[model samples]
Target: MSRSTSTPAAPATPTTPATHGPVRIGAQARTAQRPTVDPVVSGGFWYDRRRTVARVAIPQGPGLLESAGNLHDLRLAAGAADGPFRGDYPFMDSDVYKWLEAASWQLGQAPDGEHGAAAEASLAEHMEKIIALVADAQQPDGYLNSWFQSGKGDGPFLDLRWGHELYCAGHLIQAAVAHHRATGADSLLQVARRFADHIDATFGTPDSGKPVDGIDGHPEVETALVELYRETGERRYLDLAGYFVDRFGHGRLGGERYCQDRVPLRQADNVEGHAVRQLYLLAAAADLATETGDDELGAAAARLWHAMVATKTHLTGGVGAHHDEEDFGDPYELPNERAYCETCAAIASIQFSWRMALLTGQARYSDLIERTLFNGFLAGMSLDGERWLYVNPLQVRDGHTDTGDDQSARRTRWFRCACCPPNVMRLLASLEHYVSASDGSGLHLHQYVSGRYRGETDRGLPIFVNVNTDYPWQGRITVTVEECPDMPWTLSLRIPQWCRDYTLSVDGVPSARTQNEAPAQDGWLRVERVWTAGDALVLDLDLPVRLVEADPRVDAVRGCVAIERGPLVYCVEQVDHPGGGLDDVVLDPSRPLSAKDRPDLLGGVVTVVGAGYRRRLAPSGWWPYQDRTDAERGDHASPVGTGEPVELTAVPYYAWANREDGSMRVWLPTD
Candidate 1:
């Protein structure tokens, strides 16, 4: 079924005509039109974090990249400085580009307080310096890769298997687009277009004069080219994106598993190979599906999404189970201690799911976005926003070794091949984009972050809705209409899957609809009425602590249950448990769980308290495999030997390891 841009009740929203900071692609299609509120306009949790990124994270990124030799490589390539390339990885250029991208977004935001001006000025200075260095490094033909520029590689695009030429170019284009949108300076965009033109001239079939039919070892350029297309309104950039997606699965690069080209993308059902690469490919394919209106591609994306959620995902919303290959294992192969759920992979999942939500306006897609944002993606960075984790394990065993960058036992200041830190910085800087979306009829509240919404109705009438609430901690959201058309319009609020009971009222009158059977449009409570200034809509979502269990097929966590309250996933860290390791803890479902505001701890989180049991250790030095029916005679022993009643305290999973790094477990064995 082709997704017609036209809506049933309202006209389709036009493509973004003005250059904006956070451009939501495919808004004109059936998907919701994403109108991001300025970071200055939003307050509370998200606003505070955005301010931290602008003040600390963005400023700190360049120094880390400089220490890691990414900035040095660029200057060496540009002949502005003299030194041998200092980085071990060929993809170091991407780190610089990502940091620049973060800086660009930071520069673009309007500051809400006295600290805003100084931070924006600093970001502007950094953006200019990086842009100058990057432009100087570019070849006359628009080729720019610090690795290739430093003469470390034979030539440009020579080794698609290991060389990240296209990957670097992709990041460069993204940074350029962001810089252009933020500052309206055409310099970076012009440089990017030149490099993109060079790519177009060098790759593709003979008839197009760029006769190279191969895909990148990494999948990013496809999405970047599409973004460039959106910026320039050029047809060729979209074509190039399509070409890259079509060229996969031909065994041209590495066969199926290593590069995710094993089977043709349109025919493949499950996500395979490197988790980050697979997700980027699918995300770009989703962009292609909408841009070209290809139903087959759309269906393929849907299938891969279903496969991932059903079999490959963890309770914490992370992916990739095996550490050795940084690849996903067989179905239901998720493990806790040995998980390789790279922080980059989690961010990639968010990117893909966001695109999916914007493409179809499906509540489930936004559902995944909410799951990922609070758990997987947020867990990548520390509360202070300086430290980062490459791998987020659900269970951290006692005495676990810190495996160098790839699978660290705890968050690190920087990694050898650092990708997650800058990536996290960029995501947090642009988080306002994911708060809410404007469907043709009205606004749909996706994630319940406190923010403002500004957009237009189908008839091009101005609409502004001011939202105030503390979400994910308290479930009460109050939205007041500030401006809107006089005609009847709908306001849709997501009924989060975890919200079993909720109350909604417009102008202090209770909704006639009753529990569980209220009609919803795509999982949202749709309220349509004639508009008026100062109209208030109040929603109270039940926020209760619950114990969730995984499917029986998930062998690693068969009898274990995870604690959750609202959008936050809860975990028990060693600091919270005075008695023993978290591995031996078992939760009792019959006992009630209570939530408390911990203002003094972990940057102000609502901690969950519950009754549980701790395993009592049997006497050691008996036998290798002995039964413990009686202490005198040993035959066999049960995994859950004996339990002692205890009171347990759990903190948000993302807030763990900030105080101390000890045993932590999200899924506890249920007694």
Candidate 2:
């Protein structure tokens, strides 16, 4: 439990900064004037506000605060003070400290740097201690792993299949990158680079004479390498990333041993095997394709994206099937009660989709990200933002909850393999990073929200974009060009695939509009106008109740149905219907589902009221063939169904299980 405050060496290019020229500060930054109704907000730029801040703010803010506070208290209770280590997960003290580092990185990047100083200090000290521990434990070849180095002596790199060496490295790299970006402290970055270099030398026959195929069984190293390359722009880093992608599906690195080696990496379409691993690999492939401009790799990524959206994805854009291994079950086999929508998996899926949107400029990727952000991702955090659910299931059977039965499938305060909490923290902390992207032609406002972007445009123009909105809860964004070069640049605003009716306005005047436009073709409304300081653009998208049906092949639902409004999916919990069997219930789609502002619920949950039926007992022996006589049959019959006027309350699929403990079902069987 040691912490170091020493800053590591700067990157190899000490004098070179990532950005070109000097950073521009907006001179005339002003709050956008409120516009009249009748506009649409489309894009992921401000979508994270609804997803991460509004929906998950309660859970993430309070949950991490409480967890970290508890860990701090535990460390104090153990008589451990002054040193740099915190308590690990609830039980084992394995690599739980890594989660703390990751969480610190995330807190440092959060809005207004809420807990930035403490988080940065904690990460720096913890990383220093970890580096020392690694140095002391290494075998002098620069190879370091806490699990293997603490007298495990298993081997230099044994159990690549199940061992979490690379997975741990990936998390460390993420923390390092986040810390470096948030604080410009290269201490942990230097340690991470050294570890990455050691990994490169040991595996893949780079430095070692071993001809072993080099690939982490878990597909995270690829993503880390891609991020590293992006940060440093080292060709070898990109080459190493490609090496991982190339090795995938080649049967080179224990084919199918980790479920990634079975099919060629290009051939693996649907998100198979481990949910987190699958999404991470897809993200890396997308990064590689974008950075290298490799058509083959892009095509592979495209095929996989289609397969995942078409078959494996849930209504909430959640992936993974079996609750057992948190892995994929089958194509379109999404089960409401049995789903294992790991929070980390949802975050990874969003990351993958966001990268894809940037790479291909396809609105479908943004669509997927929107769906997951509002539903699956939001469901991971609790209503108060203090507690978190590791497994986000669509339904839960009453009395027999997954909590006590299956440890991995249950929602615990903390876990020994504690990656989800900190992963969520980082995602929320760096949410703005996923909001917008620019490639010079025009500013691509991928999401809609109230924020500001001050960066050099692709054309080297000093561009400043200020977005103002109250989104997800409301859809109206006023984007003002606070500062830009006096040139006609295309301002591309993404019209979400879900939005059916939208109106656009430029310079406070009504402009062209479209209805039910194809998201991929016309998702973006290009406003090519002579822009100057104080030019305003407004977009308003209609939000209506959307009835979403599952694939017919999904046997889990049968005649069941679910409801969706805006991007949020609605489900019925048994608590709302006492003694009402979900099987006997049915949704009256004709009934209108309204958005009620319930401050008591998670960021104001949407409630639905519907009608259904109930079952009552009948005679016992009416249909008994062998043992029943006519008189017996007349007196005792089988159970009879009774139709009663039933009113049931339904909450957003993500908001279920927070209320009274009861049976919950997203897909209720229709009689």
Candidate 3:
């Protein structure tokens, strides 16, 4: 909770947001622009995570791929070795491609990565080997997929409904794009283009004169094709991606809601089906809308996003609510202890939100991204980056039953499905790209971090700034302009939705606001002015710990509240309690809460100390129902000297399960 940072200058009334001065915002823009290069995650919180990824996590990938049979399957299919295909069957090849993408991003993280030239060399060497192996595994006609080539499953494209041919191919194309951008190497790009061309020639509508008129069981290929188009400047790939996006809900894949094929993309009222598939499909729609200016697609994406975030989303910003099929449950069906909240679902949510931000220039999109980044997605990976979690639940009960690998509460080195680990790897490696973006006129800092960021103007002139802060832990952000075009351009910083009040200073001088309590329209404070190097702006955001509540209809947590400070959602783990009664404890909201920096706990996090009462409970009857009067129940639940008072400690949800996973809960019963 505590770190050394410059004392921020006070501006405007501390109760009001500074939205009326040079910090005023501009018109929202939806442009077809994305960072083709990495943002400088030069130092601080993100720096450490990215460094661990490059030096530890990513370096460990190839071996995991080999041990998991990804590389072996490719070699066996290529006839370089004699063996059968192996690994997590349906999407085994996708994990390999995901790891390759992760390595490529780390190679491109810096001139030399955080660990220096040696880390760069290791990434390149691994990418070179995998890229060549992937290229060798492709058929002469551009077909690739080790499972079919190794004589498994019914041949290629035989079962489009269940077959993951396109899904795996999509990841391959994405890896190729990342590789090409990072290393300027075309070895993998060539393989991607050939297979993409094959796919284009193979699947289409009857009017397009193609053989197959179906989509894949999974919905990743849509987004992958768009990224491929961006990399290769090939309109055919973009068009192919559009075709796949529109082909959904046509009974091609049995119209299973679980596969996101139950309803047409634009006509759907809200998100449904598998959480990952829905988000991936929406992300593709956002891309198509941005590139082609398709209003219908844009509207659908926005509409579904509003619906999903309003009802289906967890406080941690994770989405999936069901474990059976990893699909979205009914609206207001957000459960705590039974929450699935798959790690892949959280990543998919961030991807979808990022694309939506690019398409709509909306502060709301970035707000969700920040929430997910700090909690849901961050929780998926261990601090050391060597282990990963497949499912992220909001609550883990005491004496929780041990499940199989994929559903286990504990983080593992790898899983049988193995999607979340590499999914996390690729996201962390490429995280810089998501931190900030430019739309040719203004620079938008959606997620704050300490680093050097570059934006651009319409003439392609670069605007660079060195940002310094401990952010997420502290509210002070100092953006010092390092370079600019000498002309005016907007510098917009997102005021997170969770922020209630803030102070702003321009050029170290206090600036006045319009006395508005929040930003005029949305949660972004923008400033447009002619700039020179060394000009600066400082914004000190209020990071008070506040209790949050869900809708009354979310029954599972109707009378409960969750804790949050800034963008981070906090949870109470049983390990931090040790008195052995987390379930019996009820928060005493009347007691004052304090925030203290715990450098010795969970790799140094800000801990919230609060008071709670372990309510004495009577044994439940066999029927588990009480006929007691309302007064009797109220007396039993009261926290006024009727229960044992206990001091409670809460930590960031992302840091849970890292020490010892006994029990953890975000929402606590309060009285």
Candidate 4:
């Protein structure tokens, strides 16, 4: 790969810079506070993706909404253009809300530069149309729900299990906040606030006179309310978020992990319930903890994080072990072929990890974010950026079919539930938020993507850091400080856990290390100094193909090995195998693996190849698993067949199914 370096361009108005304060929502107030660079302003890796979202995804989103009936439902509720509500089942409104959120972010990317000016303007118009529909659909008293309004007359907040009313509200509140942040438009915010107020008045303590308690069957409103509180600085919204979290586990919703109401947020140690719900709830709790300085909530979130990393998480950082309830399974119960690592769950995991990283300023959290983003999350969306995968399993067997219309051997543009698509759109739109963060003390580069970070330090110092690299594809990163404070400030660059050895240089000379062996500090290579414009730092990271084995407790992959190169976990897709299928492929772990850049395949990737073996066909009519007598069997007494050696090709796990629809395997049997 060719090396690239970036420098700040002529200054322009940047998107709203988020700083850690006594009141913030997503990231915790870092002692050394930092702000996220706007995706529009963040050129390179983020710019490419965001522009795709703006020009392609955002443009395509409305049609999907219209065709899916999200808008039809809203139209019916608004009494405008409709008969009965249209698509997305009972929770269609949430999809619209999520799309609105994506559009808002796309609009925010507008002022960054003139990269996609025409698309940006078009996106704004589309957002207005959607926002108007959402506002019109909302009832006179702030109640919104096309299903409840258009269906047989019934009041809201009745059923928590599958109602998703508050869930929809939560998404609306989030969209409203994003809209306000991106466009300085308060229209959506006003709608969200009104709906939130109604929720507060309707549900609360016994003295509050509400039919149902503060909890929702799905846990989203809690986090969204906190976001609303952050935007408006309203104490009531913040308190309402706390109430929902604290009120759960009272046994009113039944003791089940499916909905995560089994116990209070503060007491729950491991992740449970629907994967997306669990991560969303945990992310909200983390936000609440940061906003309120609630030690108990923070501690509980930490415990859940530990539990997930230790057991339920996949090699690609995807979570949720089972396809049945979409909930977690037993520890180390990770099964590749039967995996239910939903795309939404992977997105949720990134959200949760981002919050934890922001709240704690820990590199480990960012590490998880990097792994998930490159592998599971990015894998959901194809290279061309249209098709999507709802569930990203590591291995796909021959003759396998998508049973519940959930799993697929390949990507689809939409689904009946259709949650992942919009969810992905919003995340891709707001991806700049996760790239780099600033704390009171310094700036921390979390996920490595070629981009320019323009923001100020917590102490009010203007700085612009421009990074250039073909990261994941390339390990070398060159970060240039285009602008900075004259005084000494810390610059922390994350050294990913996968990279064992790295070399860092300041200016043109290698910095002498102290007795500590390296300038290693807090999971980062810390460089604190008085800096000037044009000062450059180059860090060379190691990228080698590695064979990884699962924990002994993970029975599904015992004696099997998975291929990994840097942060990306590799899989053997059938498209790469013309001689045989993945099921017949066996790897020799001890063999040296070589990585070759395949510029023509899968939008350009470093493909890992190694000497392996393919199983030969057994004799026809041969009885398998039948014991043969020593005298009768003679030379055929052995139970297993030793196959002939063959060369195997492996691509990134996320990049699988983007090609031909056939067998794919991450963990291959090894001799």
Model 3 CA RMSD to the hidden true structure, in angstroms: 5.7
Model 3, range 289-362, lDDT digits (tens) per residue? 77776778878888899999999999999998898899999999998888888998999999999887766767
Candidate 3, residue 216: lDDT: 91
Question: Could you give me the TM-score of model 1 versus the true structure?
Answer: 0.93
For each candidate, the alpha-carbon lDDT, in order, equals 0.79, 0.61, 0.81, 0.78
Models sorted by lDDT, best on top: 3, 1, 4, 2
Per-residue error (Å), model 4, residue 367: 0.5
> Candidate 3's C-alpha lDDT?
0.81
Predictions ranked by TM-score, top down?
3, 1, 4, 2
Better candidate by TM-score, 2 or 3: 3
Give per-residue CA lDDT, model 4, range 609-645, as digits (tens). Answer: 9988776645435455544464245333322335677
Backbone clash count, each prediction separately: 3, 28, 0, 10
**Model 1: per-residue Cα lDDT over 1-671, one tens digit each:** 11112111111111231222222332323643454434223566666666667777888877888898998999988998897899887899999888988887766666535566776677677778888888998989999888888989777788888788898889899888877876678888888999999999888965776657677899899989988998889989999999998888878886768688788898897888899899999998877776666667777887898899899998777999888778888999999888788889988998888777766767778888888888987888888877888988888987677666556868888888898888888777667666666656777777777666765667757677888777777888999999898888888787887788888888898876536543465577878889798999999988889889888988998888889998889999998888677766778877799999888888888999988887665555656455345633422323443467788999999888888879988988884
The all-Cα superposition gives candidate 2 an RMSD in Å to the true structure of 9.0
Weakest lDDT window of 10 consecutive positions for candidate 3: 11-20
Which parts of model 3 have CA positions greater than 4 angstroms off?
1-33, 36-38, 111-115, 514-516, 630-641
